[model samples]
Target: MKQEKGAEGFSENYWLENYADVDDMDGMYNARDHAHYLKAVFALDQIAIRSIADFGFGPGHLFSAALDTFKPYRSLGLEPSASAFIKAQTVLKRYQPQLLQTDLASWCRDSSQHKRFDLGICTSVLQYLNDQELAAVIPTLALRVKYLYLTVPTAAEQQRFVEEYQFVDQYAYSRTRQQYRELLSPHFTVVSSRLLESKQFYNDQTSDFTEDLFRF
Candidate 1:
C-alpha cells in the first residue's frame, strides 16, 4: 500500500511553531459558520442523516458538530494533518468515529469497506485537489452518499482573493462553480447553492424544486 500524505502545511511542526495561530487555512476557523451549515442540513429535514462521511475533517470541529446534531450511530472522518488527526481523536472521542490519516483519493479507493452513507460533507477541501483528482472524486463521492454538502472557492472568489490576498491559501486552486456543478450534476441534483441530493437514493416528491435552473 502507498503511504498517505498529510495536509500541505499542517504537519506537527506547524502546530508546535505556530500553536496560537488557529487560522491554519486563512479563515477556516469559525464555529458560527459551522452552525449555519448545520442549520441548512437540519432544515432539509427531508433526509435522515444516520451515517456521515467527512472526507477532510481537518481537526474534526465540523465533524463533531455533525455528530452532535445527527447523533448518528456510524461516522467516519479523514484528516491528513498529523496534528489535526491527533486533535480530532480527542475532539471526536465521545462519538468514537472511525478516523483516518489519509487523503480523499486514498479513502475513495478503499471506501467499499462500509455500505453507503446518508450524508457526506466536504467543505473547502475540494479546491485543494488537482483537476483529475477532483473529477475522479466527484463521481466516487456521488456514489458513496445519499446527500452532500460541499463548498469550493470558484474562479470569481479566486479573482477577489488576487485583488485582496487575505483569503488566499497558496495550496489551493481556483476552479469554477460551473466546472464543479457540471461534474456533480451527472450524479446528484442541486438541492441548493451548497447542497446536493443524490439521484441514486433521493426520491422526494413534495419538494418545491423544479431545478430548471440551479443557483450558485
Candidate 2:
C-alpha cells in the first residue's frame, strides 16, 4: 500500500505537541516492550558486538538499556523528532552516546564512517515509513551494519489491534511480515524472529508484535 500522510505527519509541530510533556510520553511503550527489546539484545551474545547504531532512538531507553547490559565500546543514535532528540540527549547524558538530529538514510548518505557498527536497531520505526522510504533506508542500514534488529507491527497484527481496540493512529503504514522481510532480503539475511506481546497506551490494547534479526 502507498504511504499516506496521516492527520499528524511526524512533523516538528506534531512532536512538540505530543511530546511536550516527556513524562506523559514515557508510558507510550509499556514494560513488555522494554523486556522484548532487552531479550533481543541478549540474543546478540552469539556475535561479538563492540559498536551499535540506533535508529529512531525514542527516549533513548533501548539504547540505554543496551549500554547498561552490553556495554558496547561505542554507541550512536539517530532521531528525527526534535523533541524526542532533546529528551534523549538529557536522558542518555551519562552514557555519552553520539546523538544526531537526523534520520537513518540521511545519516548513512552523509557520513563517511557510518558503516562502523556491529549492530543496528530500528524498533517501532518501520511502520512510519512507506514502501518507497523503507526500500531506500533498509539497504543503507544493511550495508552499514553487520546485523540489524528490527521491530514492527505486521499488517495482520495491526488489523487485529485496530479492530479489537478501536485505536487508530494514521501516521503508520501497516505491512505484512512477508512484505517487511522482502524489503530487507536483497541486502540482508533473516537470522531469527519472535513475537513480543505488549499493550498500547490509552486502552491497554494488546498485540503480539514481530521482531526480526537480520545479518548483513
Compared with the true structure, all predictions reach lDDT values of 0.71, 0.63
Give a tens-digit lDDT track for model 2, residues 1-216.
Answer: 323432122556555543555553332444345535555655644345688778888778777776665677898888887667887787779878888888765676675754567667777778877666677877677667765677788888778767985544466787888887677666665545532111111111221122323322
Query: Which lDDT tens digits does candidate 1 get at residues 1-216?
Result: 112223342555444543445675422466446646666555655445689888888767777877887788898888777778886788889998888788887777785655788788887788767777777888888788877878778889877866875444555666777887788778888777667877776545643344545522
**Which residue pairs overlap in candidate 1's backbone?**
none
The reply for model 1, stretches above 4 Å from the true place, is 1-46, 165-167, 203-216
Q: How high is the lDDT of residue 161 in model 1?
A: 64
TM-score of each prediction: 0.79, 0.72
Candidate topping TM-score: 1
